[model samples]
Target: MNRVVTHELIHAFDHCRAHVDWFNNMKHLACSEIRAANLSGDCSFGNELSRFNFGLKQHHQQCVRDRALRSILAVRKVSREEAKLAVDQVFESCFNDHEPFGRIPHNQNEARFAYRDFQNRDRYNANL
Candidate 1:
Protein backbone atom coordinates (compact mmCIF):
# COMPACT_ATOMS: atom_id res chain seq x y z
CA MET A 1 0.00 0.00 0.00
CA ASN A 2 1.08 3.53 -0.61
CA ARG A 3 2.56 5.37 2.35
CA VAL A 4 -0.09 8.03 2.06
CA VAL A 5 -2.77 5.39 2.21
CA THR A 6 -1.10 3.93 5.24
CA HIS A 7 -1.02 7.33 6.81
CA GLU A 8 -4.67 7.96 6.06
CA LEU A 9 -5.69 4.56 7.34
CA ILE A 10 -3.72 5.05 10.48
CA HIS A 11 -5.36 8.40 11.03
CA ALA A 12 -8.78 6.92 10.29
CA PHE A 13 -8.10 4.08 12.64
CA ASP A 14 -7.04 6.41 15.40
CA HIS A 15 -10.15 8.51 14.97
CA CYS A 16 -12.33 5.42 15.06
CA ARG A 17 -10.54 3.99 18.03
CA ALA A 18 -10.57 7.20 20.00
CA HIS A 19 -14.20 8.09 19.40
CA VAL A 20 -15.38 4.52 19.64
CA ASP A 21 -13.60 4.04 22.89
CA TRP A 22 -14.84 7.37 24.03
CA PHE A 23 -18.49 6.79 23.18
CA ASN A 24 -18.52 3.17 24.16
CA ASN A 25 -17.61 4.15 27.67
CA MET A 26 -19.76 7.25 27.89
CA LYS A 27 -22.59 6.28 25.55
CA HIS A 28 -22.50 9.65 23.83
CA LEU A 29 -24.99 8.65 21.15
CA ALA A 30 -25.49 12.25 20.11
CA CYS A 31 -22.07 12.29 18.52
CA SER A 32 -22.98 9.63 15.97
CA GLU A 33 -22.38 11.91 13.00
CA ILE A 34 -18.94 13.02 14.06
CA ARG A 35 -18.06 9.56 15.21
CA ALA A 36 -19.16 8.00 11.96
CA ALA A 37 -17.28 10.59 9.95
CA ASN A 38 -14.22 9.87 12.00
CA LEU A 39 -14.59 6.21 11.21
CA SER A 40 -15.13 6.80 7.51
CA GLY A 41 -12.77 9.56 6.38
CA ASP A 42 -9.96 11.98 7.11
CA CYS A 43 -11.86 15.23 6.47
CA SER A 44 -12.07 16.18 10.16
CA PHE A 45 -9.90 13.48 11.61
CA GLY A 46 -7.04 15.76 12.66
CA ASN A 47 -9.11 18.68 13.81
CA GLU A 48 -11.90 16.67 15.35
CA LEU A 49 -9.54 14.41 17.16
CA SER A 50 -7.70 17.44 18.44
CA ARG A 51 -10.78 19.31 19.45
CA PHE A 52 -13.16 16.45 20.09
CA ASN A 53 -15.31 17.27 23.14
CA PHE A 54 -16.99 14.00 23.74
CA GLY A 55 -16.54 10.67 25.43
CA LEU A 56 -12.83 10.67 26.03
CA LYS A 57 -11.90 14.30 26.42
CA GLN A 58 -10.89 13.89 30.01
CA HIS A 59 -8.76 10.93 29.20
CA HIS A 60 -7.17 12.74 26.28
CA GLN A 61 -6.66 15.81 28.39
CA GLN A 62 -5.18 13.71 31.16
CA CYS A 63 -2.83 12.11 28.74
CA VAL A 64 -1.78 15.37 27.15
CA ARG A 65 -1.44 17.19 30.47
CA ASP A 66 0.20 20.57 29.98
CA ARG A 67 2.10 19.43 26.92
CA ALA A 68 0.92 20.51 23.51
CA LEU A 69 -0.12 17.23 22.00
CA ARG A 70 -1.46 19.16 19.01
CA SER A 71 2.03 20.24 18.03
CA ILE A 72 3.54 16.84 18.73
CA LEU A 73 0.90 15.02 16.76
CA ALA A 74 1.06 17.53 13.91
CA VAL A 75 4.69 16.61 13.40
CA ARG A 76 3.60 13.09 12.55
CA LYS A 77 0.43 14.49 11.09
CA VAL A 78 -1.50 12.33 13.50
CA SER A 79 -4.46 13.43 15.62
CA ARG A 80 -3.78 15.40 18.79
CA GLU A 81 -5.71 12.99 20.96
CA GLU A 82 -3.80 10.19 19.36
CA ALA A 83 -0.57 11.73 20.55
CA LYS A 84 -2.08 12.23 23.99
CA LEU A 85 -3.10 8.59 24.01
CA ALA A 86 0.41 7.58 23.07
CA VAL A 87 1.54 9.59 26.05
CA ASP A 88 -1.13 7.95 28.17
CA GLN A 89 0.13 4.54 27.19
CA VAL A 90 3.58 5.73 28.08
CA PHE A 91 2.32 6.62 31.55
CA GLU A 92 0.44 3.36 31.85
CA SER A 93 3.54 1.42 30.98
CA CYS A 94 5.99 3.47 32.96
CA PHE A 95 3.99 4.08 36.11
CA ASN A 96 5.24 2.35 39.20
CA ASP A 97 3.17 0.84 42.02
CA HIS A 98 -0.03 0.62 40.01
CA GLU A 99 -2.05 -1.41 37.53
CA PRO A 100 -0.77 -1.94 34.04
CA PHE A 101 -2.45 0.45 31.63
CA GLY A 102 -3.56 2.33 34.72
CA ARG A 103 -3.09 6.03 34.13
CA ILE A 104 -0.58 6.94 36.78
CA PRO A 105 1.77 9.85 36.26
CA HIS A 106 5.47 9.21 36.73
CA ASN A 107 8.93 9.36 35.12
CA GLN A 108 11.27 12.10 33.90
CA ASN A 109 10.78 15.10 36.17
CA GLU A 110 10.50 18.06 33.79
CA ALA A 111 8.34 16.21 31.33
CA ARG A 112 6.54 14.23 33.99
CA PHE A 113 4.98 17.44 35.21
CA ALA A 114 2.73 17.39 32.19
CA TYR A 115 1.78 13.79 32.78
CA ARG A 116 1.17 14.49 36.46
CA ASP A 117 -0.98 17.47 35.67
CA PHE A 118 -2.99 15.44 33.23
CA GLN A 119 -3.48 12.71 35.78
CA ASN A 120 -4.61 15.18 38.41
CA ARG A 121 -6.97 16.92 36.01
CA ASP A 122 -8.57 13.71 34.96
CA ARG A 123 -9.06 12.79 38.57
CA TYR A 124 -10.57 16.15 39.28
CA ASN A 125 -12.93 15.97 36.35
CA ALA A 126 -14.00 12.50 37.22
CA ASN A 127 -14.92 13.62 40.68
CA LEU A 128 -16.88 16.58 39.42
Candidate 2:
Protein backbone atom coordinates (compact mmCIF):
# COMPACT_ATOMS: atom_id res chain seq x y z
CA MET A 1 0.00 0.00 0.00
CA ASN A 2 2.73 2.42 0.95
CA ARG A 3 4.77 1.50 -2.08
CA VAL A 4 1.81 2.02 -4.36
CA VAL A 5 1.08 5.40 -2.86
CA THR A 6 4.72 6.44 -3.12
CA HIS A 7 4.90 5.36 -6.75
CA GLU A 8 1.74 7.22 -7.71
CA LEU A 9 2.82 10.26 -5.74
CA ILE A 10 6.00 10.38 -7.75
CA HIS A 11 3.94 10.48 -10.94
CA ALA A 12 1.76 13.21 -9.44
CA PHE A 13 4.84 15.18 -8.42
CA ASP A 14 6.23 14.98 -11.94
CA HIS A 15 2.89 15.95 -13.36
CA CYS A 16 2.74 19.05 -11.20
CA ARG A 17 6.38 20.06 -11.65
CA ALA A 18 6.96 19.33 -15.32
CA HIS A 19 5.25 19.46 -18.68
CA VAL A 20 4.59 15.76 -18.89
CA ASP A 21 2.81 14.59 -22.00
CA TRP A 22 1.51 11.45 -20.36
CA PHE A 23 -0.82 10.35 -23.11
CA ASN A 24 1.17 11.49 -26.08
CA ASN A 25 4.73 10.90 -24.94
CA MET A 26 6.12 7.54 -24.00
CA LYS A 27 9.36 9.08 -22.90
CA HIS A 28 7.60 11.25 -20.36
CA LEU A 29 5.80 8.27 -18.89
CA ALA A 30 9.00 6.28 -18.92
CA CYS A 31 10.85 8.99 -17.05
CA SER A 32 8.27 9.15 -14.29
CA GLU A 33 8.21 5.39 -13.94
CA ILE A 34 11.98 5.30 -13.68
CA ARG A 35 11.91 7.98 -11.05
CA ALA A 36 9.13 6.27 -9.13
CA ALA A 37 10.88 2.95 -9.21
CA ASN A 38 14.19 4.44 -8.20
CA LEU A 39 13.01 6.88 -5.57
CA SER A 40 9.95 5.22 -4.14
CA GLY A 41 11.84 2.28 -2.69
CA ASP A 42 10.32 -0.01 -5.24
CA CYS A 43 13.84 -1.26 -5.89
CA SER A 44 14.93 -1.37 -2.28
CA PHE A 45 17.11 -4.23 -1.08
CA GLY A 46 14.35 -5.99 0.83
CA ASN A 47 11.84 -5.68 -1.94
CA GLU A 48 14.32 -7.12 -4.42
CA LEU A 49 15.17 -9.93 -2.04
CA SER A 50 11.52 -10.78 -1.61
CA ARG A 51 11.27 -11.08 -5.37
CA PHE A 52 14.37 -13.28 -5.37
CA ASN A 53 16.35 -10.62 -7.24
CA PHE A 54 19.20 -9.84 -4.87
CA GLY A 55 23.03 -10.07 -4.83
CA LEU A 56 23.84 -9.01 -8.38
CA LYS A 57 25.85 -5.84 -8.95
CA GLN A 58 23.72 -2.87 -9.88
CA HIS A 59 20.65 -4.79 -8.84
CA HIS A 60 18.87 -1.67 -7.75
CA GLN A 61 19.19 -0.17 -11.19
CA GLN A 62 18.20 -3.39 -12.87
CA CYS A 63 15.17 -3.61 -10.60
CA VAL A 64 14.22 -0.02 -11.36
CA ARG A 65 14.48 -0.62 -15.09
CA ASP A 66 12.50 -3.82 -14.81
CA ARG A 67 9.78 -2.23 -12.68
CA ALA A 68 9.57 0.76 -15.01
CA LEU A 69 9.32 -1.57 -17.97
CA ARG A 70 6.54 -3.53 -16.27
CA SER A 71 4.73 -0.36 -15.32
CA ILE A 72 4.97 1.04 -18.85
CA LEU A 73 3.66 -2.22 -20.24
CA ALA A 74 0.81 -2.26 -17.76
CA VAL A 75 -0.37 1.24 -18.58
CA ARG A 76 0.50 1.62 -22.24
CA LYS A 77 -0.34 -0.18 -25.42
CA VAL A 78 3.28 -0.20 -26.49
CA SER A 79 5.29 -3.21 -27.54
CA ARG A 80 7.76 -4.64 -25.02
CA GLU A 81 10.59 -3.61 -27.28
CA GLU A 82 9.29 -0.06 -27.52
CA ALA A 83 8.64 0.21 -23.79
CA LYS A 84 12.04 -1.22 -22.99
CA LEU A 85 13.64 1.18 -25.39
CA ALA A 86 11.88 4.13 -23.84
CA VAL A 87 12.86 3.02 -20.34
CA ASP A 88 16.44 2.54 -21.46
CA GLN A 89 16.50 5.94 -23.14
CA VAL A 90 15.51 7.81 -19.98
CA PHE A 91 16.88 5.49 -17.31
CA GLU A 92 20.13 7.29 -16.51
CA SER A 93 18.68 10.75 -16.14
CA CYS A 94 15.37 9.86 -14.53
CA PHE A 95 16.91 7.41 -12.09
CA ASN A 96 19.21 10.16 -10.82
CA ASP A 97 16.51 12.84 -10.40
CA HIS A 98 15.83 12.46 -6.67
CA GLU A 99 14.22 15.88 -6.35
CA PRO A 100 12.02 16.26 -3.21
CA PHE A 101 13.62 13.30 -1.51
CA GLY A 102 17.16 14.59 -2.21
CA ARG A 103 18.32 10.97 -2.23
CA ILE A 104 16.93 7.51 -2.69
CA PRO A 105 15.29 6.06 0.42
CA HIS A 106 16.36 2.46 0.49
CA ASN A 107 14.13 1.33 3.36
CA GLN A 108 11.21 2.32 5.56
CA ASN A 109 13.30 4.19 8.11
CA GLU A 110 15.04 6.18 5.42
CA ALA A 111 11.70 6.95 3.83
CA ARG A 112 10.36 8.20 7.13
CA PHE A 113 13.39 10.43 7.52
CA ALA A 114 12.98 11.74 4.03
CA TYR A 115 9.34 12.48 4.73
CA ARG A 116 10.28 14.35 7.87
CA ASP A 117 12.88 16.35 5.98
CA PHE A 118 10.40 17.07 3.23
CA GLN A 119 7.85 18.33 5.72
CA ASN A 120 10.43 20.61 7.29
CA ARG A 121 11.79 21.89 4.03
CA ASP A 122 9.92 25.17 4.29
CA ARG A 123 11.28 25.74 7.78
CA TYR A 124 14.78 24.94 6.55
CA ASN A 125 14.41 27.36 3.67
CA ALA A 126 12.99 30.05 5.93
CA ASN A 127 16.02 29.69 8.16
CA LEU A 128 18.30 30.02 5.16
Best by lDDT: 2
Off by over 4 Å in 2: 112-128
lDDT of 1 at 59: 42
**Per-residue lDDT of candidate 2, residues 32-85 (tens digit):** 999999988888888877888797788888888999999999999989999999
Error of 2 at 53 (Å): 1.9
Q: Which RMSD values do the candidates have, in order?
A: 15.8, 2.3
What global local distance difference test value does model 2 have? Answer: 0.89
For each candidate, the alpha-carbon lDDT, in order, equals: 0.36, 0.89
Error of 2 at 126 (Å): 12
